[model samples]
Target: MAGLGGTKMKNTWQQVKKVGIVHRLLSFWSRDWFLKVVSIWLAIVLWVLVGGEDTIEKTVNVPVEIINLPRGLVVSNQYKKKIEVSLTGPRSVILDMDDRNIVRQVDLSKATPGTMVVNNDVDHIDVPRSLTVQRVQPPSIILSIDKLVQKQYAVVANTVGDVAPGFEVKSIRMNPEYVMITGPGSVLSQLSALQTSYISLDGFRRSEQLQVPLDLSPAIVSLIGETSVTADIVVGLVVAVKTVELPLVVQEKGLSLLPKTVSVTASFPQILLDKGKKAKDLLVAHAERYGQTDQFNVIVTSQNNEEFPVKVISVLPRRVSEGKAKLLRATTKKKSE
Candidate 1:
């Protein structure tokens, strides 16, 4: 009975050891264990799909960006602002990218005026980590850079409505006469004329200076100094005109006059006529010393006793002829007499 009892103990110990081994083996196949194995397998599968040998080559249009240009420098030529990028990477990564995800940037912080070719390098492009840049469609870009410059342009007053009745706008003058502007060279070349803010002369009767803003489009140009300019509107009493016939002195020997005598109308300040500066004398003097163009005009003295200003009001025949055959017959007859 003792031996049989010992044998039973041994058999129980063996069975217990066998059961423990079986439990250990079954624990390896539990739900948590299966989950861990599946996670590792999925990680390998994802690696193969995203970073592995299954790569796709595709061409996508990416925006070309210019950054950090030096002060007073600009791109002056029309160029392709976009580029095509050929990418080689996992299918999942390459197909999911759009223009927003990738870009080719050119830095012009140290660029100077001239033509330059910029190469597309990996460092200049931004792309996803999983994708490889096979090539850039343009491979390079050509840029024409120029220095921004300042220019002066005459400003013309744009007026609305006429001066008050019986009071004429004698003269309009700008204080500065010109405006200084700064812009890109190409843009400045297109701008040859400039205008001022609309001024209304409807009921104006007095000589006054007005502060008017310069009408400039801010998109392409910038004002250098003052944006507002002074417009001098001179108004005076309108003088009635007296008409007279005056002989023109031919400045050039071979010059011909269209008409022997020109009808001249003079509008002078009442005080000048009161002081014995007759309209006939002033008109004859003006016709005698008319030096600028072939046409003669009616002029008023800018100031007291000064030479007549070159303000041309009107001329009858708008043109002059060359050659002695068309010279004035009256002048010839007077010379002969």
Candidate 2:
């Protein structure tokens, strides 16, 4: 009972204080009814006029971002990456604006192949709500949309300059013979094959493995996945023709060549010829291989029959008499002494 009594007394005292405060407020307002109202309204009007006059206008560049782009579509033509915006707001707000975070987004979800003009609007810009966007520069932007194309192209290897003087390229090969590329249809449709950057073969004497890059302009097109490919170049010594006379040989007892020696033109690797090798040491002319003593074809072969050793190009007076065939053996034997 004692606690309840104390609580009632505290509530009565709080109510009395509240009533007294309200009575004084009413009395103060009643004292200057019309004049006080005018003064309060005038103060508000002055604050509004001063604040509106203190606003400033500023121009800023906001990066443009493409959003909601449809599938199988690409922006073919070059377009502005950023848009310029002019904004006006309270001086304090403009000075404290986070301009770096401002961005203008252009939506392309409804775009298709061809040219499209999208009008720039303040709604596209993201700025502080307290700041007002007065105007956006570049009333509109033009976009060229193209169908995204994907294709597989054969990789053609290209080489520039010559191999070493005595060397030649046997074959040029690429590891990935074909590549898949995705790009705008405008360019990809006109191209048939993709070529690699020209590989230099200057003074190259042996087979080599090289990293070759593709010939692609990033501004126009792009390769899928791989930027470069492995190149396998097969190099070999150049084959050269060498002409020399060799003594004709016949094993048959009844025949010999009319001319004791025959001019033989044969092909050899440049390295072999550089060694100053004698024709007789590298090759032999046998008339018996044809099994005919009269008017037989001159068969020339390597002495040791080595690999890629020799290739006969021509033989002067390729035929011989049956009786002359016997003289060839005698001439060779006589030279042996």
Off by over 4 Å in 2: 1-53, 99-101, 220-226, 240-267, 274-276, 283-337
Clashes of each: 0, 7
Displacement of the residue 250 alpha carbon in candidate 1, Å: 49
TM-score of each: 0.42, 0.59
- Model 1, span 1-337: residue lDDT tens: 9999999999999999999999987887665887888899999988876557577798888888899999989887767888877888877667678535577778898899999899987556788777778778677889989888989888888889987655678899987788666767877787886778899998886888999987766644333533778999998756656665665555546545555556655565554565576665665422332465445433232333432222225555434343233356666878999
RMSD of each: 17.7, 13.3
Report the Cα lDDT for residue 172, model 2. 88
Candidate 1 worst ten-residue window by lDDT: 301-310
C-alpha displacement of 22 in model 2, angstroms? 19
Residue 33 error, candidate 2, Å: 19
Residue range 187-304, candidate 2, lDDT tens digits: 6888788789899988898899999988876653433543788899999867777788887887766555677678988877766667786655788887654554356666677864
